[model samples]
Target: MWESKVNIYNVFELRSRTLCYFGVGAINKIKDIASALKKEGRKKIIVVTDEVVYKVTGAWDVIEPALKENGIEWVMYTGVQPNPTVEQIDEATKMGKEIGAEAVIGIGGGSPIDTAKGVAILLEYTDKNATELYEQTFIPERAKPVIAINTTHGTGTEVDRFAVASILTKEYKPALAYDCIYPVYAIDDPALMVSLPHNQTKFTSIDAVNHVTEAATTLAASPYSILLARETIRLISRYLPEALAHPDNLVARYYLLYASTIAGISFDNGLLHYTHALEHPLSAVKPELPHGLGLAMLLPAVVKHIYPAVPEVLADIYEPIVPGLKGIPGEAEKIASGIEKWLFNLGITEKLSDFGFTKNDIPKLVELATTTPSLDLLLSLAPVKATKEVIREIYEDSLNPMS
Candidate 1:
């Protein structure tokens, strides 16, 4: 019935083309995934990661041996920063190009993987630099293949074509998605995620929750995407707290990782909405704020604002998280309130003001959000039309969420 109603529009597409290897020992299969390129005479590869991920997780210890054992020569570009910037992308791209890497292997969370996608984009569009790439001055038709080895259970960059890179000079963060940037393969091993710090795990899990929430509520959501989004929310609601409480619980980590990948696919097809659009400006201006934290802070306001436009959709989404609350009147507000409580329980009770965002910064955030070219698609996909006033109102609400 939901499908019949939603599928009335016959002009949409969904594609999950990434070859995925999931489970306990998926990391060991990297050499097998990379061998496909090596067989085609692509011997050299670049591993894109951050310094913190490299030393903390011992990712290199597992990945390097696999590459060397399989005779795949590789170089390392470990300069990726959180909320990765164009400068970081350019730095990694230059390193990748100088080494003549035929492919890129991303071995961290979303930032490094997204940076790797940017590097792969430049590898093909040799004429374009990171600035031009983020500016949309050049549309790439192809890129060197990428292998994503996910170390965090967030961002789903491992299996999605989308990549978000920040341009600090412009005070903008743009999410770039093209067919060319999709990783050819992905490896999701829960063992790799067992040691994730509580803060990173908490925020990243929230990021996945944000992905599903936005995808399910976006105007572009199809019946299929909603189903996936619903399942993602269910898994996260049940498993994320357990994962946070017991970091070594591989079962919890696996479900969260599974939920994240499903959410990524859901959003990749249905797209995101104003919540993501609003969060981008915050992270772009204050690159230190974790993306999921910003999302958690802004989500309740965005949901409340958009609830009137899609009451049925929000009701369906909330039913799984807060059982027996679906048929009640004002369910949207209840859901919004429930989300705030959940975030507070997870230790994300801080407001935007706590992060140095004063009311004076509202105008700048609104301007950047409204003017950012990359967010046009998501803005259009939002259930409620976000004008400058609406965006400012959301930012103001985020300033004191508890109130």
Candidate 2:
């Protein structure tokens, strides 16, 4: 899809350390990861998860058996919820410390995995807690090794070095990205993903799409990022609909899983900008809001704002979804409105107001976007810098129907 790219001289730096396995039967490899840990005399582990996904995905069927056979005793911490909070991370960290679990396994989507990342830090820095980890001043350089068993098709926290947790009292959702959080092992089994609910299939897949979009256009954009982003967009555009129609179709689930994985890798190297920087605030203010929905709400407006600065990159990556308009000039609003409609067609019919936000909330969203810990750093990566006024415009433009 990035046929127009011709920059051969821009320097690139790609980074990832996780040993990841992908396929229908890859979950069994957890046996290998666990057995190696057992050899190291590490017998205790904390399984961080939201209660439902672990069992519903049948991941527990594989993980429990593997851990038991490897003589690894586990403590279960199931308090994680969507847009995981500091309180939840601290609760799990306390349980993990009580058991002296030396390593952590995260099972489920981003929330559980992100909580596990937070727990991994608090476990090593025993005196500190999740509150300190999210304070934005402490950049953790060392953490207990994490093993990620992914159950959903989006938020490749399994494969990426990013985690997020909220400080509810401060209405802050701060994301932490560090080399230390990269999982020691990552398992992405498409078989575990076929059972995903229809809404989750849509929401999670859209999150991956947003990831690729931002990766292709962020100021950190590289040929490596663009290459992965193109293939990710192609696969998701072809497969997300089929997965939604036939939730049990393994082939569709397989490609979507790969799509999400590559999308994760794309961002790991390319970084992110407006969509994520802005969406975190929406969920922080309403902690129950689905993260993908928040991204979907802001994505079109964010794209509109940055399109002029990186038109070629935006056009290249969006070709699969919006055809015949790639190289055209003066089509920012068209692409923006088209994506907004596409999201609505995928069943996310609710607007920002539908989620109880209004013009009154614009100032608050702006405040959070510009002031949230590392989010300002992300704003710096925008091709078009996100000032307070620009942040407000994106939030306001997202408040209602643009079509």
Residue pairs in collision within model 1: none
Question: Which segments of candidate 1 are over 4 A away from where they belong?
Answer: 1-7, 327-329
Compared to the true structure, candidate 1 yields what TM-score?
A: 0.96
TM-score, structure 2 vs. true: 0.97
lDDT of 1 by residue, 1-403 (tens): 2343464655777878898898988887876875677688888988899877766666567777767766888789888888999999888888888989899989899999999999999988877899889889878889999988898987988888899999898889988989888888898888889889998898888888888778877777887788887888888888988998899999999999999998889888888888889999999999999998888889888887787767666667666666665433366577678778878887889889889999999999999888886887788888788788888988888898744
Model 2 Cα lDDT, one tens digit per residue, 53-154: 999998998889989999999999988889999999999999999999999999999999999999999899887888888885577889998999998998
Candidate 2 regions with alpha-carbon error over 4 angstroms: 1-10
lDDT of each: 0.84, 0.89
Model 1 residue 270 distance off true place after TM-score fit, in angstroms: 0.4
Determine which window of 10 residues in candidate 2 has minimal summed lDDT: 1-10
TM-scores of the candidates in the order shown? 0.96, 0.97
Candidate 1's clash total is 0
Q: What shift in Å separates residue 344 of candidate 1 from its native position after superposition?
A: 0.7
